[model samples]
Target chain A: MNLRFQATKARTSSLVLVSPALVLLGLLFFYPILLLFFTTLEGENIGNYAQVVNSGTSMQVFLNTLRIAAIVTVVDLVLAYPLAIYISRLSPAGKAIALFLVLIPLWTSQLVRTYAWMVLLGRQGPINNMLIWLGVIDAPIRLANSEFAVVAGMTHILLPYMLLPIYNSVSKIDNSLFDAARGLGAGAFSTFTRVLVPLSIQGVLAGVSLVLVLSLGVFIMPALLGGGRVPVIALLIEQQAGSFLNWAMAGTLSAILMVIVMITFLIIKFATRMFVRGRIDVAST
Target chain B: MPDLRNTSALKLESIRKTFGRVDALTSINLEVNAGEFLTILGPSGSGKTTLLRLIAGFVTPDSGRLAIFGKDMTMASAGKREIGMVFQHYALFPHLTVLENVMFPLEMRKHSRRDAADKASAALAAVRLDAFGDRYPKQLSGGQQQRVALARAVVFEPKLLLLDEPFSALDRRLRESMQREVKQLQASLNLTTIFITHDQEEALVMSDRIAVIDRGTIQQLGTPNEIYYHPRSITVAQFIGESNILEGTETPEGLRTSSGMLLRRASPSTSGRVLVRPEAIRITREPATGGATNQFKGKIASRTFVGGFTIYQVDVYGGDTLTVRCLADEGSMFEASQEVNLSIREADCRPVPQDAKDAGA
Candidate 1:
């Protein structure tokens, strides 16, 4: 009986210690989400949700958002994996310099970085001028204000997110394992594929999930670089709220985006759990 | 007909390796016969691990010729050298099951999956870990993990095996048992193995022949008995066991210490150190009555009972304080400040030449 009472007293004290942060979160985060939900029901009916779910254009925008996020994720991973591996193999001073370069862009405002990409990809920019000089093209082409421009800008902006996690995971592996693999008759290629890749998979998954989720809800880079040529869910929601002044419709779109984010998170979590469980099963059997 | 049974498994001719400013291994010339278990014994940073890495092809010597089975392998990569290595930390792949870890080398050599699994099972059975083939390395105890490492190393049947202090993490009893198991397994497979360790007792218990290393050089190489009883240098004598080193000059009669104590020993050198093991000196309360060879009268400065033997630091009259060990069942125990007579025969005192350069100074 005394032990149970002691355990209850410990639990009550911990709850009291954490109550301040919990109250702050309730007011700042949860209250706004609750307000957003009630505003979506402004007409005292589910008409706004029904309109978004039934509209072909809104559904097309949703699919476009997923496609763009996927493309961005693939591009980020292809560029990040090898770069992270290279940075991990550098000396201490070299690693510091390399990581500093990777993080320098994050210090600048995202809007400013997007405008920089706009200048590079403009029709009369250096990229097009160089193409003309090399005789690869007769005239400057439409490089900016397209889906390709959005992807390029987003990839440049979000690369460090993909690189840092994988680098951390790869650097934490025991180096003796590589020597052990090589001493056991594995050549360089086999050793890397069998040892390095499987051990650093956790980092790969973390980077991929972070990049994918961030890309899905991105707004500024796509809105500026795409110049109305491309439309993602965030851009559509902004148009509904700012241009049309349709608060209920905007709230409904935001709710849908929030649901998609939650689903994306669940899918990634489920996939990772399944992957780890599968490995455990293979080991046990 | 030439004898085929005497082929050398490995030969290192004048192997010398150096880091940027450090000499890791200097002028190492050694050979191992087929199926021989040779241990490189040294203190830390003594270049024993460097020598093993050189043999395993992880280190390229600055100058030398390394041959395995009479074939030169000086420029070969680690994977092409056909040497199995067990790291001090066991280094079992954390993601791989015990059976899969053993099967890795076989798979790398292009064996079929079924064949690799079968051979891995057999190897696991050899180490008596067949029942644990499904467990990951982290799930096993330290001893079990070491056994898995041993099984994985030998499964591929490499020409030479190198073990880098494989049992330093286990408890004393478990270390002894693992030592016996590894020795038996090596013998049964007839594997030419080179084991490295800093523990002198482990080296003596496990190695067929030991190479005592000091500061990038092999100080002595011989059987355990020769190393224990007849160390040629003062460095080897002091490192291998507890001893009372009496520094003196050799006269026509015997060795005469600076403090006027004469010890009986035949020596070719003008001046050297004589090693008398603590247990070799006979300590008694009565004085010598017969042919007194090298006898001294001393008072016990301190007594330490170490279960098997009682150690006494005896301050001899006008000479060095010598450590003497007496067995527990010696019928009498001397207390502190008790006068005792210590006697040692001439054969028990081995003269060790002073090395030209002190190692690891």
Candidate 2:
């Protein structure tokens, strides 16, 4: 009875410790997801799901989402890995400054930042004006409302999400591991591949997973920058719910997106499991 | 290329390393002969590890040359140095299996995966861990992990093996036994090794010669007997082992102690120090005991019995302390506070340049 009472006390405090995050996830995330799935089953709108998938515009939007997400995730990983590695070499003060600058974009709303790209990449924006002045081009280059602009805007917002986790993971690595690799007859390239990259894979998985998942739901960047050219699932869902008053179709599309996000996450989770377990086995023996 | 295992012939010429403003190693020079176990003996913060790093090529010397078999490798990468090293923490990869860890060097040599695995298995067997080939480093005992480290280092048959206090993490008994095992292995393989240690007794047991380092400089480098019995510095005497010391004063015959005792003659500098070996000092309880060069009297200050021996500290005049070793079988006839006479041969009481402390400890 005494042991059970102690166990109950421990459980209660642990629950209390995580209560705020649990409440937020339940209210803002889980409840909305449940509501979305429930609304898709409403009796009158069964054919609405078929309408979106069958539409030429909706099919294009769906493919665009996968394409853009892949491109952005790859870019994020490539750009972030080098930056994270460079940051790992910095002193504490230097690292703090770099991270502060990297995360500064996160302090602002994504919508406002994407709109700022409007002023910069617009027809008469400084970039085109400079090009015209240099006689590089006779006319204002069409920079805004393109797939390239949308990718740029989304990558700008999501880069920190990729870099910070990788940076944290790289920093925790035992610096002596590098020295050990060198001592074991490994050159610079071999050491980086065998030791640095493999050790920091956990960070890569996390950063890429989060960025890929977040990119799936990015509607504002495509809407503002793609100029109706870069259709994506998020934009289709928005149109179905708002202008079409077809909430059921919207819910169905949301469910499909949710399934994809979960599957991607599960793949990532499995990979991370392999890594953590591999580490544990190595440690015990 | 000549075999590194068969010969020593290592030189660190004017090696220097600076971490910012702090000098980790400064103009350090050392040479070890072939087929010898030379221990770089120093206290922590004495740049001993840094010196190892420079030789291993993990850290480039700011200004110096590291030569193995008299071949200049100062600008060479760590892989190019081809020296085997055992880290203090063992630094075994926590992700790879034991065999995989051992196979890493072969893989670096561009050996096929199958060949690397075969070599790794052989290396594990050499460490007497054949059954543990599939296990990871963490699963092994501390002693076993040390063995795996040893096998991994020598698996490639590199000639210059460097050990950075590899046994410091093991228990005392395990350390001594491992020392014997490593010494036999080195002798059998004829591997030239530069071992670093802070323990004087360990150095005495292992190295053919010892370089006693202090404050980033070599105070003295010689055979264990030469360094112990004929230390040129006060620091060497204290660092090497325990000592009984008295201030030195010049005498007509040679150097004298504070007690007006004339000790044996030794090379004298204008400013000199005297050193002596404890084994050189003779202690006897019988009053008629004579024939030794010098004699003194004291009560047993303390007596502690080791399993095979009894160590007696005799408190002599002028507050000098003398340690007397009596074999277990010989039996200690004196108890604490018992009056005893101590005698040492004049030859054994050879004065150091000064009484760096005492003639005999």
Candidate 3:
């Protein structure tokens, strides 16, 4: 009886310690998601959803946002992998320097970073001024308030996020593993492809998922750097809620966007779980 | 490429490895024969693992040459060297099943996957693990993981096998059993093996020749019997087995003890110190029955009774202690502070080896 009482006491204390974080998470994050889903069901008769779903403008905005997110994610990975390798190979002092450099952009507000991109990418920015100076063009190139400008800003904000997780993962890989592979006759490319890349899949998935999910909800970058012409799903929701004052329609479109985002996340999560945990030859063997 | 299995031997000539400022190996030199089981025995931080890693091509030496079969292989890559390594942790890929781990080298050697799988099955069967091919390394016990590591290392048929304290993690029984298994397998396959271990018993039991290493250098190399009975240095005698080394003084009327006892010279004791194995000393009840060259009067200080043998610590005068290995079945009369006569023949003791001076220096 005393043993049973002690066991219960231990479990009760463990649950108590975990309860505060769980409560905060449920209220702050999970509650809003639940409410968002409930509002989708609350509006009278699929009428609000039908209006948002049938709108061609909403469809175009969704595609445009998706295209930007996909392109940015791919480009970000290409730039981040080498930088991650550089950081992972650095000495302790060099590592400190690399970490400071990576985190420096994160210190300021993300919106301010996007505005910095605006100064660099504007019509008379350094790129055009350089081109004019070099006699490559007669006039300054029209650069700002375009899709390119929004992509530039989004990439800048999200590049460090992708680099850090990958750097941490790559750094933890036992260097002897690469030596072992090479000793066993694996060429450089094969070693990287088979061993290094597979081992670092957790970081790849983390960086990809973080960048994709974060870019989907991006508002200020598109609103400020991107002219009002290049409309995104966030812009559409703003139009519906602020201008049309159609809260129900905004909620329905948000539900659709949330579904799309969840589908992408499900694919990534399922693939990552299989990539890391699934026996590489579960069925074939 | 060098023929690693050719009848000659592996020689590391003045091999030196330094990382930036720290010297890991300094002017190291050694030779391992084609099929001989040579163990690099050392305590931790003695650079034995670094030496193995250098030969395995995991790290390139900063200077000097490594020759296998008369071909200089100092700068050769690991794939070209074909040295198989068994890690202390076994290092079986956690994600791979037992059979897949064995087949990895075969696949790396460009064998067809189907053929590799068949050979892997045979290798696993050799280690008596055929029935466990479906289990991952983590699912197996420590002994099982060690066998899988063995199977993985041997499946490729590498000419040289390097084991870095492979059995340091097993229980005593398991270690003994695995040591027997590894010795039998190595003899059957005729593969040259270099085992690195700090455990003296494991080295004595498993190695045909044990190389005692200390502070990044080989102190002595000899057979187990030779190392135990005829040790070169005090360190080797102490490291390999129990012994009693007395610091002698050359005085009038022969080599005498600190407490005015006369002992006959053994093998020209010009060197100030002499080493003697504990078992070589003969303890008898009668004082002058035999014409023993050396004799001393002492009292048993302590008796530790192990099952097979009892070790007696005798306090000899002039502040020197002597250890005696008595057989459990000796039926010898002995007790604490019991006055006894200790005698050793002139043939059993000698001046410590020259390497002992370097070790001391």
Candidate 4:
């Protein structure tokens, strides 16, 4: 009886200790979101949401955002997987060097990295100069302010996110499994597809979801590389808040993007839960 | 590639492997007979696992010739060699069900799904795991997982099966049962198997022939009895079981011990050490007479009860300390500090060459 009372008292004290952080988070983060939601509903009522949905330019911008995010996620996956595998198989010194290369870009500011791509993709940049010097083209080509430029920039920025997780999972795998698979009469391709790829699926899922969600909310890459040609949801929200001073429309757009991000989070969580469950079927034999 | 000879299932000629500067295996020449259970026994870092990996095609020898079933497989890839291996850790695919793991080899060979499933089920049943086909590897016990690995390896009926200390992870009772199960499985299938282990008792219990390996080479390769009773060197005798080694010079009758006691030998040799098994020596209160050619007086220094036997450490009157194992008969107990005579048959003492001793050191 005394133990039960002490346990309850301990639980109450733990809760009291954690309540300050909870209250701080609620006040600093969630309270602002609640205020933003209310501001969207003020005066305009449902018309702001209707405007976000019905505006053809807004619709195209939303679709273009999804398209660019999807392309960036795919391009990052394709580029990161082989590089992650290569890094996972390297010698100790080689692995250190490879991981250093993957991480050095991340230490730089995201804006600076995006602008560096701008310098490289410009008509007067070294790429165009090289093309002309090689006689591949008679004139410097227009490479900046394009969707391709935005994707290239974003893929470069998000690649380490994809590569690190995949590298972690790949490195965790026992090399003996590869030997066992090959010893079981599996060719190199068969061993990789049947054994290595399936085992690393969780890492792939984590990386893809991270890249996808981050891509959806991307602002700087599109702003700097797209140069207003590739306006996405974040840019639309920026225009409503900054140039137009339409706070209601901006809040409504912000609420929609938040909902989309939340839905993506839910889908990814559900998919990961399913995949993990499938991987470990703990049944009594 | 030349055709393999019918008599030998696997052959290794002058196999040498070096890792940067360290020699993992050197001058490893051996031939495994068809359907024979050959065990490579050694302590850790003794090149047993290296030899096994070489046979499995996981590690290529720096210089050697390897042939399987009359075909030269020196440069063949692991998949092309048609060899099966059960790794020390089992190495079952965590994401795959037991049935799928067993069916992997068949699937790789392009068998139809239905056919592969049927064969995999048969293999699982053989390992007594038919009902657990749908379960993942983590669901099974260590012994069950090992059996699953064994089933996966043998499902394709490869030319050779290599087991790399597969039972080292299990507890004592489970290890013994799994050893028996694997030996029985190997016999029933008539499969050629090369098993690697550091456990001497397991090698004696499971192998048709045992190769005692150390320092990147095979020290001795023979039948279990040959390895135990007639070890080629003092190192082999010491590694395989308990032995008391008496260093001495050769005399007319036998070996002259450093302490001046003469130990009789069936065939006299110039100079070497004599290895005497502890159990081979007989201890008595008075000097033992007749048929036994060598006798010494000693006082018991200590006694240890080891379940079935009482090991007595006897300090001989001359200089050497001899360990004598006596069967645990309560009535025949010898107390510490009691003087006793130790008698050993002349033929039982083995003379180990000085060069082999130096090589072992």
lDDT of 1 at B219: 91
* Candidate 4 lDDT, B177-275, residue by residue in tens: 999999999999999999999999999999999999999889899999999887777678889888988888887778888888788988765347888
Comparing 2 and 3 by lDDT, which wins? Answer: 2
Give the TM-scores of the predictions, in the order they appear: 0.90, 0.87, 0.87, 0.94
Better of 3 and 4 by DockQ: 4
Q: Provide DockQ values for all models, in the order shown.
A: 0.53, 0.56, 0.38, 0.71
Please write out the lDDT profile of model 2 over residues A154-193, one tens digit for every residue.
8989999999999989998877678778877888898888
For DockQ, candidate 1 versus 4, the one ahead is: 4
Summed backbone clashes in each candidate are 0, 20, 0, 3
Q: What is the C-alpha lDDT profile of model 1 across A1-285, one tens digit per residue?
A: 699999999999999999999999999999998998899999657988999989999999999999999999999999999999899889999999999999999899999999998899898899999999999999999989999999999998899999999999889878888889999989889987899888887788888889998999999988999999899999999999999998888989999999998898888787777656636665665
Q: Name the candidate that leads on TM-score.
A: 4
B151-254 per-residue lDDT for model 2 (tens digits):
88888888688999999999999998899978987897788898999989999989999998766667789999888877777778778876655456766566
Task: Give the clashing pairs for model 1.
Answer: none
Question: What is the alpha-carbon RMSD of candidate 2 to the true structure?
Answer: 4.4
Model 3 chain A: ten consecutive residues of lowest lDDT? A276-285
TM-score of chain A of each: 0.91, 0.89, 0.89, 0.92
Tens-place lDDT per residue, model 1, B34-136, is: 9999999999999998998889888899998888888788889998888888999999988788999999999999999999999999999999999998888
Give the poorly placed runs of model 4, Cα more than 4 Å off.
Answer: A1-14, A91-97, A132-135, A280-285, B1-4, B355-361
Candidate 2's docking class is: medium
Q: Among all windows of ten consecutive residues in candidate 4 chain B, which has the lowest summed lDDT?
A: B352-361
